[model samples]
Target: MSGVRLVMARHGETAANVQHMLDTRPPGLPLNERGHTQAAALGARLAADPVSAVHASVAVRAQQTAAPVAAAHGLDVRVVDGVHEVFCGELEGRSGRAALERFMAVYEAWWAGDLDARLPGGESARDVRDRFLPALDGILDGASGDIVLVSHGAAIRLAAAALLGDTAETRFLPNTGLVVLRPDGDGWALEHWDGAMPVAGDVTAGGTPA
Candidate 1:
């Protein structure tokens, strides 16, 4: 294929996730038992691809999730700094209705193009793009076959919106959820998201597959 097929997935849940707490700090948390199962399932599902490269965030959760997938391809997971989870800063470890709402508000604004918006003591969406895009582009440019990027939820979501344009169906990728992207000219095309793939000639120019 002339284009790189990028399979970007979110890391499985963590104890923080289970407790609804924001866990984006360094030397990140390990995956819980349920998270491990989810990782295994993710690996099993994506094992069919002839994965040429496997990349993950510096976070432990991401590395853990990428482990099985990397093993399937007999490749070692490469840690990419830029792909780490959004630094929620002040919100770290704070879990509650208000905290969550505030976190989601920033994301909503980000999706709506408010790249400059930032949570207290945290980075902006633009910050994420600056770091994330280069790492992602490096992978796309260097990979010879399909590749998988095990990244955090917010980071991956922002990259998809920035690189592939906004798609309602992919507004959020659940833990271990993935979306497939293919280079389209100078832009990228969203081929699959939220477990749905596009049927050829059945998709609109807007990129929604029937």
Candidate 2:
């Protein structure tokens, strides 16, 4: 097996993020000004790595976030399928506290190993994993060296936890925050998560948001 490291990043900020909306849809909002700066910083942060490929989901924000990093490596940001955010379904565009709580409640359920839990009119944890794992495999198909993928928060958290058989290293995935993984036997080993090694029993938050 190759020593290829997978770096999964959450997309930069968007208006919806600031508003606390469940903004999960294809071709969703673009990154705001601050998001642009974060994108550049993320690019610079990873430029020195031997990044062989850069990828993004279908969301506009995700693509925008991957642009700088791909440019840094002289690589095109491959717009991939099935690696987007967790679909919010009926909660899409809803920013109310009740809806947000409901969504998080179900998301929390997935974190508790209840993969069948689904948001009303949305995907289940099992649904996310089925589509995501395949998309991730396809992204890795015939690929090598370091790779970067700009995606979403909950999606990244769910997938990474499932892949590593560990609880999410952090609860949030702030804009451009990274979750690094390396090949280990038939699975993967969690490397630096959200830019640092998490301490056991630590209840970290913002440090993980993206």
Candidate closest to the true structure, highest lDDT: 2
lDDT of 2 at 147: 81
Kindly give the stretch of ten consecutive residues in candidate 1 with the minimal lDDT sum: 201-210
Candidate 2 per-residue lDDT over residues 101-137, each given as its tens digit: 6786786677677889988898897898888889999
Question: Which of the numbered candidates is closest to the native, going by highest TM-score?
Answer: 2
Cα error, candidate 2, residue 43 (Å):
0.7
CA shift at 102, candidate 2, in angstroms?
0.9
lDDT of 2 at 114: 87
Candidate 2: which stretches are off by over 4 Å?
166-170, 195-210
Q: What TM-score does each of the candidates earn? A: 0.88, 0.91
